[model samples]
Target chain A: MVHLVIDGKGFQAEEGQNVLEVALENGIEIPHLCYHEQLSPYGGCRLCLVEITRGARTFLSTSCTYPCLEGLVVRTDTPDVLRARRLVLELLMPLAPEAPRLQALARQMGVTETRFASDEEVDDCIRCGLCIRACAELVGAEAITFSGRGERRKVEPPFGEEALNCIGCGACVFLCPTGCLHMEDQDGVRTLDKWKRTLSLKACASCGRRYLPFAQIEFARQKGEDPPAEGWFEFCPDCR
Target chain B: MGKQAIERIVEKYGSDHADVLEMLIDIQEKEHYLSRETLQYLSERLAVPLTRLYHMATFYEALSLKRRGRHQIHVCMGTACHVRGAARILEQLERCLSIKSGEVTPDLQFGLATVNCVGTCALGPVVSVDGEYHGHMSASKVERMLKRYSETEANGVAVCQK
Candidate 1:
């Protein structure tokens, strides 16, 4: 464990955690977005800025990326830190006005409205790169990637082709807090609700009972695959 | 097999660092990662020596000359992630996959790595499976995630179909 003083409050935190982790662990509220715990630290949004002082040398850095050090002094609610955070919010507002989290954070920071203007109209990407990095770094499909360059850059699958490698895992869908990426179960192959089904009664011996699309099961069986077990029902009410 | 390709790359940029990086990036993208053959061809054409090129490639994190598995799992260990149980999620992945960080599965289906951050702190405890982020993850969630991918792989469906 490492000891640090944050916002005039002394606290002890586990070693190797970043300042943001330490602050939050100790109940110090620091405003931020674009810093998902699961994704890598991008430092793109520039929110979560904090002031760290060590022997009078104070500087600002995104707490999400700043690793905690022994005896470090940190402040998240300081005026300077607040000023920097406000500027970052100002820049992000114009990019994603529809995002309630972003809007709420901006309002909390006293940025009731955005002064920044963007001539190029586009959807809510904010370009935080959570989806792109997630696809490339975590999934290994390299199915979807960032294409184009600079401001023109957008996440796209290869040749902008319909994502072939996309297993419909819904990782990207869940990770995208902004609801930018959406998925639909056209074949009625229900996997997203797998967790919910686990809590319900077991289905027929042939097919698990929670729910199964009849057409989909029949299609699978017609393809020479085994149908649901003896006790398993053929289809859910919707399919029937 | 083709001198024309080498000629095209060399003639266009003329042995500069930026040019070399760009050429390597193109080659890497084409082949998925830099191969020995591609590096040799570059070394011969650029006349900058293979050792120097290797050094430069190693210096940049973006470039990977080594063979990468089909899937790369980069768990974010950033501050926000750490507080939000990213470590537990990573541990779950490692346990379920039966591999340590940076190790590819014996079947060549997956590879695991940890990244400092990817800038989405709002979604703490994020897990990127094969470059797709799965946010707000728990140990159970990670297990289900791996099972889903493994099932897809078992089904012989190209894990990344596009």
Candidate 2:
């Protein structure tokens, strides 16, 4: 455990705990988009910028990737930090103009308008890599990934083709900060339109309602998972 | 010969996953570009994920995922080279090839690309063909250079020009 001061409030955190997690755990909100609990720390989104003074070195770093140290002084809303964070948000404002999450965060940070934002309808994906991380780490599907670089950098599956290995898991859609990735279940088929993957939904034997994709159950079984009872997966949670 | 590179790369760095980039580079050196089939074979032989390999293939400027021309042409577009009519040289080359700077002729005879600098800034407007470098280039010289490689077998590489 290590002692730290965030916004002048003292707190104790685990040695390897990143500053963003520590601050959020203590109810000190630091705006972020790319940070996920189950996935590894990826500071792709610069919204979590914070000023840290460790001993004598004072620098601006993304709190999500900056691990807290003993006697570390963190300032999340400093003029310098806000300036940098707001600048990142401003750059994203136009890239995803219709993203509610981005708009709400901009309003919270007092960034009403952007001089850089163009009136062009562009993709809502901010390219934060959360979906990619979730697919690889959590889902173990490795179905989605990032391709290209610089201006062309984007999260996509292999060759931007339909993902054959994807089990139609909606983890990526659920965790997406901007809601750019979408999935829908209709006609007993689950469609991940973003990945161009469609899977047949498993209808409950008892309730006769689609609850999960069959591929997901097969994937879980292949990973050495077993149902609680022999016929457990035959019914939905409510029916069980 | 192409399959041998992958076999050798896997034999050498089979256990070390950190050297996947090195393996890809070695294969690209021998194969010119990374095809989908080659990547699939590498993924299975090396046990590395295809997404990770695809990331590196698309990420690095040095690695190419598509088949290149029989001959590779690299033009220096550095600050010094640009001032010495490198842009004109590139434009002339494009006009002759009927393709962009980063494009290959549909005949697969020539692949034209621009390099930042080859550290030979004094010899500004430098163009590298295959592994050979020509210095102090102008728009007029592009045709003479293309004549040397244009007659080579479009399906094969290396007719050995001096």
Candidate 3:
């Protein structure tokens, strides 16, 4: 186990674990978006900053990507860290005012309003890149990505066209923290309105309820054979 | 010419994920802008997804997804340059070219853009035309700079300029 000091408290972390994971595991909250446990860390959102000191050097680093090193000192609530986090929040506020998750985080940080002006109003995709990372890493489809640049930057399918490779696994919907992604399940159809795409769902053989996408089932089928006792293609989890 | 050259570049980069940025730069240098075909070819050769390539292309200002002109003009808008009337220089260029920033002229002779900084604060209010730096730019000097690019069309009507 690797040992480190966070907020003046000694903590032990398993090797290869990031500071954010260890901190959250130890009951310390460092507010962050664009970070999912299953997806690779993409430090696009600079909100999870912590002042890390080692030997004689000290600097602010995003806690999500910063690995736990022996004898490292991390301070999450320092003045500089708070100031930087507030600035990030201020910048992100105008782009996604409708996001409940972001609003809750702003309240926790005591950020009342944003000083900057934003001409563009984004629904919930704050360009934190969580969905992009999830689609690329977790789902392996890489369906969605960031498009445009600077103030016009946004997440969308490649070139603002439909994503041909998206399998409609809903991993992006599942991992999105801001609730920007919307999905609808009707009859046996799953519609991702953002991507303007839809896929067919597999109805449970026993319960006749739509449980998962047919493409996802095929993906699982390719992974390995189903158990002989409970056939994979026949029924959903609840029905089985 | 573009596809064959891009194939050579992919072969040169050798599928190393870390060299994606470098490969993109090289391809952009050769092709002027990243075309759809080039992006798709690079995606397949480098094993990077097309969406990912698009992401990278859009993220960096140096890369352009759309077709650009033969000549590119970059106006510095860093703190030092901004305070030194770079905005007027950019505005003048826009007026003379009849195009906004991130646009190309109808003739496709020039493309206009702004960069945050060029790391040369000493050369405040600098404008780089096709990689040739012009320092201490003013609204009046913009005419001369553009005239250097178009001699035959020097008398072309500017859409709007104060």
Q: lDDT of all the models against the reference? A: 0.67, 0.86, 0.84
Candidate 3 Cα outliers beyond 4 Å, as residue runs: A44-47, A56-60, A76-91, A106-120, A221-231, B14-18, B77-92, B119-125, B136-162
Put down candidate 2 lDDT per residue, A171-237, tens digits, no spaces. Answer: 9999988888889999999999989999999999987999899998888878775434567679999
Tens digits of per-residue lDDT for model 2 on B1-162?
366767887778764778888888877877778888888887777777888888999999879988777688999999999999999999888877777888887867788899889998988889999878899889888777777766745522332121
Better of 2 and 3 by lDDT: 2
State TM-scores per candidate. Answer: 0.50, 0.91, 0.82
* Residue-by-residue lDDT tens digits, candidate 1, B20-96: 88887666544446666776678767764454455445545556666555667889999999998888888877877
Give a tens-digit lDDT track for model 3, residues B60-153.
8778888776779999999999999999999998988889999998877788999889888898889998888998888888877877776366
lDDT ranking, best first:
2, 3, 1
For model 2, the stretches where C-alpha displacement exceeds 4 angstroms are A118-121, A225-229, B1-5, B116-120, B131-133, B144-162
- Which candidate comes out best when scored by DockQ? 2
In angstroms, give how far residue A199 of model 1 lies from its true place.
26
DockQ of each model vs. true complex = 0.02, 0.79, 0.66
Q: A85-148, model 3: which lDDT tens digit per residue?
A: 9999998888778788889989999999999776654565678888888877766777888887
Tens-digit lDDT track of model 1 for A29-113: 8876666666677776688899988766999988988887788999888889888888888787777778777877877889887
